[model samples]
Target: MKSENNYERIVQNSKKFQHSQKNEMQKRITDLLQQLTNGIHERNQIMAVSLLGAIAGHNTFLFGPPGTAKSLISRRLAYAFENPQYFEYLMNRFSTPEEVFGPVSIKALKEDRYLRKIEGYLPTADFAFLDEIWKSSPAILNNLLTIINEHIFKNGDERFNVPLKALIAASNEIPPENQGLEALYDRFIIRLLVPPIEQEENFNRLLDSKPSSDKPEISEDLKISYQELAKWREQLHKVKLSTDTLLIIKYIREELAAQFDKLSVYVSDRRWQRAAVLLKASAFCNGRKETNHSDVILLKYCLWTTPENRETVEEIVMHVIKSCGFDTDIDLAELDREKESLDKEINKELYYSQDIYDTVEMGEKKYFPVLATFKDEYYANRDKKYQLFISFNKFHSQDTFNPIDEQGNTIDNIECQFDGQGSCSLKLRGNSYHNQYTPLTFKPKIIFHKGDKKLDVNKRLIYSLSQAVSDIRKQLIDILKQVEKKYEEYQQYLQSPFATQVDIDIAVSGILDQIDKLNLRIKDCERLGSLCR
Candidate 1:
């Protein structure tokens, strides 16, 4: 009878949980965020994003030095759940599987059946935190990947479904180059930089405060059970995503892939799908039945692999978000490519030679074009030129018979001879003539001509180059206009009389700042266009 009553109680509570107002849910999350991030404004983004990722059922990785409240945030998050069953571990290179998954059951071993006692370990927890996570051994690392990715633990004969809602991991540094670590690294969808306090005032405040001893009193209204979180996740699929939201996602993905060749950054298709889910959950948690532009700001937390890449990815995503739909169709890559081709074509050089003529006395000393020909031996220089020379040659052949020792007695071997000789002098162009008997030497002088025309640059080529620059400038101007128009829209949305919502004022400023910077780039483009002309 008691068990039946308990079952009925659970049913009633679940119904109440499912029907809770969206505003109330957001309020609970916000309340938790405020308490968790109190007195630390710099790390508030990290805190808030961690909460959202956890609520969305994705793993979060905190990377920073040792003392920046990485474990504190996880503990705060674990405390937010009702009757939270938690697991926390500090891993090292020698850590074994038994330390994480719990020891093998001796009774089961005696029975020749293998099984583990996983009750108090990560496999049965509502939330878990692993510190220095990259230091784990392969034996522990492989099983860790399976549990995090599949949320299932295999214990001998049976597969046990892990009850974990969130897993928070921290590391002083990213894993060094190693094998078997990539799969574990890829399982964490959200990576955050948890830098220590940099501001003097914040640091002084930290010094004045006692190490946080008071847990935010978890009111019944603020507490979320694992079951309730599961139900809310089911509702995420029903959250409306507009066509524009999908279009923005597509554009961002393409841009990221394009930048990867130059930036050495890459994101897999699986991460992209998970990113969509996170955006949907962001909307669902913020009391909205549909996703809006604001929800996508969460993507800044989801896309980067390294801290340096984090800033770049945020810049790209914010640019897309800020454009508010006008940024599409502006393929800067293709435009830049066209610009390069024109630049190369305009600067290339060409060369040609003109023919020269010499006077040859035919009928009456008429001048005509001379086509040179060579007979016998001729030599040319490295530049393929044969120097002109003034020269003359004479040849003689003779045959004589002995004064006939009277009657045809043979003679002195028939007496035959041949001889040749020549006189020559160098001739220079445009010099006082030492004219030889020959009027011309049949050597045509070679001359070279060079200019822009040799490069094939004409009015048509210049006009095309200038036209391309104008087109690019026009494209940039169009994008700028859209950015300004979208900013105005965002302002009106924020100031609307019916607005009773979490204002996206920060995102608004971020987008406007991005637009302003884009306008500056447009000015640069204008200067570039003029130079191209």
Candidate 2:
């Protein structure tokens, strides 16, 4: 009884935890996000996700044409941090390493040492944006890979720990294939397509509004400090991936593997590790202890490799996420198999497998024979061998049948009309021999299980089957309750500062659909249970 009370207490605590309100940190983050994204039209998703990438210490890539506000979004991201050292550069083929990393130090050059003054450059900045990144030469791109991946820049013989929190890169086109830029490209895990304003109303608002500032007026209290960011990064590692999120990831990997030939999409183990960090950071920022389906929906932006396969990869991710509902910890597949096995056992024990009927043998064919009483009394006094025999099919049918001899030969001038009440009238030799002829002892077959069985069979099999169905019904009801509770908790997910409303809706809708499916399963189980009675 004490253990039962403890279990109840645990359940109540879990319910409270699930429905808890957002914390102060989450509220501040939400307000900060709104300040950063204010006056931006149709760019909420990109801006919000970019900020998330920054908070998680992941690089971002924006792919689109020149006038798509890719640079603007990157510039606005620095405003989220306090006094961030921001950097911006446009790359071309003629760009040299000295121009990007800073010109070689003249004072150090006289000492026969190669070194670069890195002040006011990419390596020293906290947030950087490189536009037209693919246009740069290999010399600049190779060093960039090192900086973005390890957060370390080597100036001559000395390596510096770069303060770069997030490096957002923008490009009009992806790097050319076989150019050996794939490694550098893979470092940017959060990839988004920054397109022009899609809706006409938003576009008109953009046309009417004045040019927005590169840095928005965010309050100092709202702006994240370096100390806070560092502390949050440490705390982000503690955010666990929930079972549902892991299941969604596994399903996505399986689906991608299945479509590898057509999609040519491959996600590396390192990339997955980085992506998991991003999801954990999202959970942390939202004041949750674990990731959920809402965070899993962000994989659509992270998994695509190129613009061509972007839609296909997004479809694969969303299809997997939408198909997988909340985790109920019950094996539905095992329940279905058990139900099937029980059905087969019930059929084997209670119902006949083949048709059952009585017939009389005549040569190679079988017929049903009946006794006839004639008005002439001549045939009635004959031996039993003179009894009328008809085909089995004709005996069961309502049609008129002719009588046959004991040798299976049809006898002419003998017509019989069955009254469908186990008796028939006969006309013998064209004379009115109106007599009632009753059929022989015959019983039709019983094949299906209509719950009519012997007492022992019902006690042994049907009772057990009904109990099993009841157990399954209980399991389904439990799952339905859990899913319904998750549906209620969706409002908390919607309050997340990182995930967009559209994404939250998709995840919530997918999980809510499971409630309907679970109710259907419970009803089917009830039906199965009723069949036993």
Candidate 3:
């Protein structure tokens, strides 16, 4: 966020020199953070936005490990606001409220009313940071509570209200034993988990950025005005919330609730509220009246607060949030069932058809006892004309042919033709080459033809498939709309049980089954139709 192109910083410097409205504000910060880590579990860039909004007022808590960019990135980001008023405190047992709020003003003591005079410190300045906030005792946290909320430092019994535009606090961990940690932690709406730099370059940057004594300065009026901060707040309220979006949010909450019992984790309401704030903050930055789909680019902080909860939040967004209004369990189940059935059908065909031609060759054969003989229409011709007639493959050839004695002497005259009679010819090699055929037989076309309906059915099926695909796309769109609208709501569950992930394994299995069965059926239909033709 600390780039040379920071127009916000330029405007602030301009205000110091009182320049004309150049409209030369550069792009907002967080470009790299967004580009490199766009939606890694949906934690919004709160520090960046809050830092921008709160030149008049902003506070944050970056919690995680020691090497996480807690103080490093936050301090750098704070510099863009008001030439950077950096007030850092490594909180410890000895840390006093005055160390953060600033010592009581010696000059104000002369006045009748007691007020802490700030020559130069946190009390008079704007941007501040507190490192290892929870390492300090409850007394310190208690002292900070009033200062953080009221923007005033209390001395003895008197309080001095100061202009605190922003504060970036940090903790090594979200400790369970810390008695007052939760309340103190809640003050930081922009709660981010900073991790050790994964990229070697960022780590190098951190090591190279050693503490420097150089100071940057500008006139007092260059500081951000309360009016502008108020405008941001006002502008946030005007953002719209669509009904479809609300439905998506509700669905996400329901999903979270359903899985809470299983995961043994809960997403608190406070986190949801904080997510809403972040959503608005992002909307404010984009110059949008309200958040749209594209704004989710970095606003995931509203959803997740810890590294562990990031997966859960991500599932809600990438799967559930992305797949809104769609539950394909039935389609999947049916497809699976069809696949099983088709497998069995194919397996049943593995056995080849037993020879039935020999059994039927006997005169007037009744065919094999096991094989069912059904009446099938066969081609037969009356003089120069073809007519369909029921023929039996089960005739008893023994009765139709002349009886033969035990000596194997045949009495019937049989005709054998070669080459459909090469126009009607026969061989007479047996019986001393004297026997031959005389009558000629004709063959008829055996095509089973009817009105062609395949084209119509194919067209209908294509239309239906297209319609189904359209329905699927519409459902997906509706879901995305809901997610876009309830982005804050979706984020709320990211770290909570309500933000549970869809069973990827199950979903993938089901989808694969559907595709496989659909392909199989399509293949079978085409094959059968071809064979029949």
Candidate 4:
């Protein structure tokens, strides 16, 4: 069970030992985001998610046109960590490996072996940024792919582990083709589109706002240290995802394939695994033991491989989330997905146990006109004698009739068709239609009286399923309330004067929309549950 005051308890404990440690993680993160995006508005999502990704030790890519603060934001993130060895580089196709890794070692060259000097460069940086990252030559990109992924710098015959923490890469646009850059592109897990300000008010603010104070140099007192981050990064593995979140993920993957061409949006197995880590990191940093519905939103940043696929991925994720109720768990989503199959299975079972008797008379010798007997006699014997009308009373108890064929089998081939009035047409499947017989006159016999036990069983099963659905619905309602409360808190914090550096309307809107979707899903669930009856 999760403690209601987990966040407070954790913060209070951390404060006792070191107040700045736990408290400063979020504070410094928000501060850096604000400072870097001061004049910017409506892009709080990029800043917030980017900060989370950095905290989780995942690299980020900011793609947009020039003057969108990509470089500024990347630089501010480096400073957010205390005393980081920050490295910034602008790469081009002509760029040589020495420029990024380091100049060829003068001492190593004397020994007739190839090597790069490793000091005050990308090889030693705790935080680094590469502008126009895809523009780098293949040699630089290949070396970068290894360094960024494994933190190892290879020079000559020696391999040294680098001290890098997180690397931020900026791009004006994604590379048009893989061209051997697929591996490098995949390394930057958190890809974001840094579109220019959308709202007019934000644009006006950008024009009138003063340039941020000189980008602060790396300062140990203000930065989040590797030790501090390592503590939570390890905790990320323990963060659990609720069943609803998993179902939503599964549904998105399925929907993406069904609705869009596979080539347009392809997510690799490795990327999904890493993306889960990012989600876990988000929940852990938020003081939760398990991920909630809101954490699923982080996937919007992870799944999109290109700007073209970004909006579609977001819509897919959000739509899945909206279709699930706030209280939706793995069990509930499973039930929703398997509803049709469940109904079919239940109905099939009920069919086997279905009542076989047609009449209500019980424990009494009651005679009923055999439908097959009446039809056979009426067709075979009626041709000998014709009548305008025949009363059904003679075919009842007073008459001795054979309801079985000469083969000693019960007449089971009897079938009837009602024609509006208190009358019906009875005929055997193999029997030829007689022009003289307009409609058969006979009372249905009580072959054997039996209760509709299968019907009762079906009702019971449906009722039980309905109850389960109702329980899940109720849980979802409660969960919805919790999400709403959290959203309100975020809004209040955003509205506070001290924290009014950026607008999170878009972020908050996405969250609110998710909440609304939960409600819609809950309603759908209710309707589905009621269907069991």
Candidate 5:
């Protein structure tokens, strides 16, 4: 009797050990998931439910199109729980709810059990998959929604709830259009768009993956019993929320509202409540009770469900990340370019005013001829070569002639001809033909060399002086233009090289850094894709 008792004790001990091993494995899985993603509220939703399913002994929806590895996530979730009850469906137009919910357990119906026999499928199964979920009709959609949300199936007056964990719905497109879209779309608490494997290099890696064999049915093995999940469901609900994470989610919703104006967003009281569950679960999965940033990306993953929203869903998520906080890289160059345009406009309007033409033309007409007379001593003291002169003195000597109006009446004080008010200027600008006589050079040469000792004398200069005075005016204006050109060159030298460089260089450097940082962030993402591939 003692020996028999020892064998029974050993058997009982062995069973306890197996149960303990399962619990330990589950705890480890929960811990591993917590570290894998950022704890953004959105991500926390995905993580929470994933763990909730493990605890609750249910499955989750791994949504999105081909190559995004939507099904892979489902498989991983099942693997994580060490629960073999995870099932996946790549749905189509022909798929019926019964196909996923299981045939009314036809064989059992014969046994007089009116129950849709719930032998397998979603109602009785631990986890289930439904791909292309939107393709189904309102009847099917409504049935599934009721089951997913309530975790209960109705057979006539009888209601049966199962240990359904999570429903990962996948789709290549958005929820169908029409009035019913809202009703069905609202069921997916967490929507995620799985994009194609990015980068051509990752293509080969995906191709190499032997598509997982028909996901071993979710009913094969379920570790956490339904009773155990219910025990922790309240605790999961009690998960703490940090103030910062809440603010971020609110901000994301606002931002999405702006970008996704076409599709209306009406997050219910339930969504907010669930979001907390997700945030907490995410922390739990990663072995953390505290939320953090890495889980944020998972939240982005959830916003996609319909094919239409996939692009915008990811876009909204990335924008949050890039813009969050003070760690942003600014593109100074683009800013400077925009700013510099304003200055250019000001310069064009100010100094380069259209009114300058009027000013110049009006100034030309305002010119008054001047006249002057000076002693021979005064003339000799001046640069003889400037036989060229400003002739301001011409004003003093000129006879002022007054001009008349059209009626030839004297316009006193107005410088009209009848009033004898116009002024003629002559400052003896090196007298040209003041008297009809021999060239001035001939007289100068003869006076200087009374004896015939002539070296080459610039006789042509005398001829030049003898020429008409109008020709001299033209030559003087030409010389004035050359002086203006030189002045402009000097101004350019003062303004360029260093003065302009310092300010622009700083701004340009800032812009370059902005572009550089964005590029680096993208590269890191690409690298992540490589690792995933």
Candidate 6:
């Protein structure tokens, strides 16, 4: 008894924790995001997502027309960290590497050595931003790829690990095709299209409001320190990818493959690996030990290569995530088949094998034949010989139906109505028998269950069916409870600074729909079990 009481207490405690769980990390992140995006119009998602990329230690690329506050976003992102070394530059075709990387060292050059001063330049910065990045020469772009990928800078013959955290690059257009920039372009995993203010109210608000500050005053407590970031990165590796997340990834990959001819989208394995890291970091920051479906939604911002395919890729990802709800190991199809089989077994054991309707055989066709009596005094002694048959579908219907003869031909001028009891009435009408047929009641032979031998129907069979139904119902109820718990946990995602409410709704709607289907199956099981009782 003590052990049982202890088990009950454990279960109760588990339920309590599930309901009251709060993600302190997510709340802090949300507060930081609000501070970062203060006074920004229609750019909250972009700012929040770019900050997420920075926290995840990944590069971000913003693509749009000029004057869309792309540079301002990167500048504000630097304030999220303590004493961030921020660097900004605008690139053009005529620009040289010295302007971006820093001027050459005069003393080193005098000694016949080639070295560039790396202070106050891209090499030493913790966060960097480049505007019109596509116009940069191959030399600058190539070096940037190394810094973004490996955080390494080569000055003269020595290699030093750069302190760069995340580089935010922006351009009005994509890099030219076949320009040897694909490798560098792929380094920036978080790609976003920074369109102009879309809504009229937002556009008006943008025109009416003052320009947002280049560096918002963030609280010191909210600003992440290098030590905290390093520790979080270490913890991020411990975050596991849930099975539902992996299934979502697999489905998206397969769908992209199937549509490759139409979509022309190809994601390299390296990019996928980086994307997984971003998801893990997301879950870690959101106070989750494992990546869930909400984190998987962030893949839409990571997988697309160009603005043209961005919407398509997002649709595909959303489709997969919405279709894959909480992964419960219950096979509803198999359960349905089990219920149907048991129902058939019960009917076979208890009900008659032959047709319930009284049928007469005529050339391999069986039908019910009835008679009609004349009501007219002129034809009172005359009884009409009419062949009558009830349709297979009319057993439960009250509608009048035409009678068919042994040859399966409709006997005109006669109508039959089944009362849904055991009896039916007929009406006759013809030139000779007009208004002359009395309604005749015919009782079809009743077919009952094997009443006398019901005891011999293997009590084990009925008991087994009942037990199966009970087990199925219990399993379904358990799965439903799990789904409810998952939903409750998902409520925490509403506070997420990265994912949108629309996407969360799509995922939750799909899960609820699946739960509804499971409930219907449970009802079917109950009905099936009743057949035996």
The best candidate in terms of lDDT: 6
Model 3: per-residue Cα lDDT over 1-533, one tens digit each = 32333334333433433232212111233332333222222223443444543532446667777755466555555544445456777887787756765665566665645554444667666667778877777766776787777777766576678667777787777645438566666667565667655677655665676542223232244333456666766776666643423444676677767777654345568656555555555555544455433233222444554556756765664454343322332343454455445334332332222322222223442222111111212322211211211112313221222222223344233322324221212121223333322333322222222322232234554454444444433443444444335432322222111111223222222223333344445455444333222
lDDT of 6 by residue, 70-182 (tens): 99999999999999999999999998899888989999999999999989999999999999999999999988888877789999998999999999999988888999999
Which ten contiguous residues of candidate 6 have the minimum total lDDT? 446-455
Stretches of model 2 off by over 4 angstroms after superposition: 1-21, 347-458, 485-491
Model 2, residue pairs in steric clash: none
How accurate locally is residue 401 in candidate 5, as Cα lDDT from 0 to 100? 38
**lDDT tens digits, residue span 121-229, model 5:** 6676566667777777666778887886777888645897766676667666666567476655665656543556556655665466565443333322343445555
Candidate 4 Cα errors over 4 Å, as ranges: 1-32, 39-42, 214-222, 260-263, 326-533
In order, the Cα lDDT scores of the candidates are 0.65, 0.80, 0.46, 0.64, 0.46, 0.81
Better of 3 and 4 by lDDT: 4
Sorting all predicted structures by TM-score, with the top scorer first, yields 2, 6, 4, 1, 3, 5
Whole-structure CA lDDT of model 3: 0.46
Task: Provide the clashing-pair count of each candidate structure.
Answer: 0, 0, 27, 5, 58, 0
| lDDT of each residue in 278-391, candidate 2, tens digit only | 999888888889998778878888999989999999888887887897877788778778877876766567655444445677877766665654444445544222576767
Which residue window of length 10 is worst by lDDT in model 3?
A: 382-391
lDDT of 1 by residue, 1-533 (tens): 54354345434433544344436657677777666666554766777777778778999999999988888888877767788888999999888888899899999999999898999998999899999998888888888888888889999989979988899999988776657586788778888889888999988888998786425566677777778888989998788875557767877788898999765667777887788888788777766776666777667777887766788888787777655533445765576576566545444422233222232333333322322222212223211122221111111212221211223232242221222221112122221233112112332333333321343446676677667667766886787777677655443222211111222443444455556556665675565555445
Clashing pairs in 1: none
Q: Could you tell me the lDDT of residue 16 within candidate 3?
A: 39
Off by over 4 Å in 6: 1-23, 336-467
- Please give the TM-score that candidate 3 achieves against the real structure: 0.50
Worst 10 residues of 2 by lDDT: 438-447
Candidate scoring better on TM-score of 3 and 5 = 3
Q: What is the lDDT of residue 241 in candidate 4?
A: 82
